[model samples]
Target: MSNELSVDNLVTGYGKQEIVHDISVSARPGQITCIFGPNGSGKSTVVKAIAGLLPAWSGRITLGNTELTGLPVHAMVRNGIVMMPQGGGVFPRFTVMENLRMGGYALDNKQVVEDRIEALIADYPNLQRRRNTAAGSLSGGEQMMVAIARALVTDPEFVMLDEPSAGLSPALVHETMERVVSLKERGVGVIMVEQNIREALPVADSVYIFAGGKRKFAGTQKDIRDDNHLMSIYMGGD
Candidate 1:
């Protein structure tokens, strides 16, 4: 497992404002690389830029051998880049199986898709039990499961999560993070933007702190634990 995804000197912004400026990042294969920052620090914006929701104003984002700095979202997906947005990127009206099927829409192999679905169900009982339930009716935790399962449907090489643990009970948050960890066990690169810094730190193999649209600090969890530097840079200062 080497660098599965890499971003270099990225410069991007919305209509009139640039949020990510001259930024770079990389997610090593089978590793959980987390981007942590206070709100408005352009973390999610980075995800958008990578997932092709926003065009890269400048710089290169290379995934494996693909230079995907400005590829459209659809093209990115076909290229093995998929995003699991926060708040559960589930369609409220669709059943679990329906949502999962949509994820593999790009796949022409019907048997492969069906096999994968059955395998995911065996691994995640939560999804298996609620296969027929409308996604909207599930609890926040259950919905999160559906979202992750759906994203896996595409057989993504790298899965970017935007606050996977955001709005759930503590128990549910733990469940969501655990699910994310499971993805890594299966050897998928995960880049996440999480607000729960404390909980994320434990699972994060590498932690990146962003401030003013640039990387303020970067290191492993042990390198930053209980250190005042994180709060000094990521607190109200920025």
Candidate 2:
């Protein structure tokens, strides 16, 4: 009943190599928890491990009182945990409507799916305008919106996103960050791995900065801004 997603001492990696060391983090409802680092810092690795896309070599992942350690990806979704990977996680060939439908595949009721889709279209006017358009045809920002909206079709309690602002314009990056903040307002636990430090810092409630596959700092926005050492790490200084 805690309504928080917690990862404890997580260690995961590709075959015969550990990319993520023993790292612990938590995502609380109604707040944004950001994980940020330079390339190869294992930020995405941790996200994948929590999403059940990668197996943890050790440690535990929990949501409320439920243990999510070994659950498959589908079971994680059923348990109200959704992961929207990087690069706009939609089927490129499918229409926006079809992609939305696929997002609610876990639901058994057709009316529920329709209702959710309708609600999403109302929330995102762009989606309504492009409902029949192929997902691949949309711009980067629009596709990002579809990926996020699709994740919400299941109404997940905990949502994870990887580098949503990777290749977006300044305006679109601002817009995307705003949408992420809105997710927290809706009482969803948001765990975001972002490279856009400027955009991510303002909206984040807490932050974890990783370097060399290990957590270098974990604190609030103010803490990050005030610490010169942390800033140095971000600037690629040894």
lDDT of 1 by residue, 102-180 (tens): 8888778878888888888787898899899889999887888888888888778889999988778899888888988
Model 2 stretches with alpha carbons more than 4 Å out = 225-227, 233-238
**Which residue pairs in candidate 2 have backbone atoms (N, alpha carbon, C) closer than 3 angstroms, thus clashing?**
none
TM-score, per-candidate, Cα-based: 0.94, 0.93
Judge candidate 1 at residue 21 and give its lDDT. 78
For each candidate in turn, give its C-alpha RMSD to the true structure in angstroms.
1.7, 1.9
Residues 99-175 of candidate 2 have per-residue lDDT tens digits of 99998888888799999999988988999999999999998888988998999988899889999888789998998
Candidate 1, 30: how far from true, in Å? 0.8
- Output the TM-score of candidate 1: 0.94
Q: After superposition, how far is residue 54 of candidate 1 from its true place, in Å?
A: 0.4
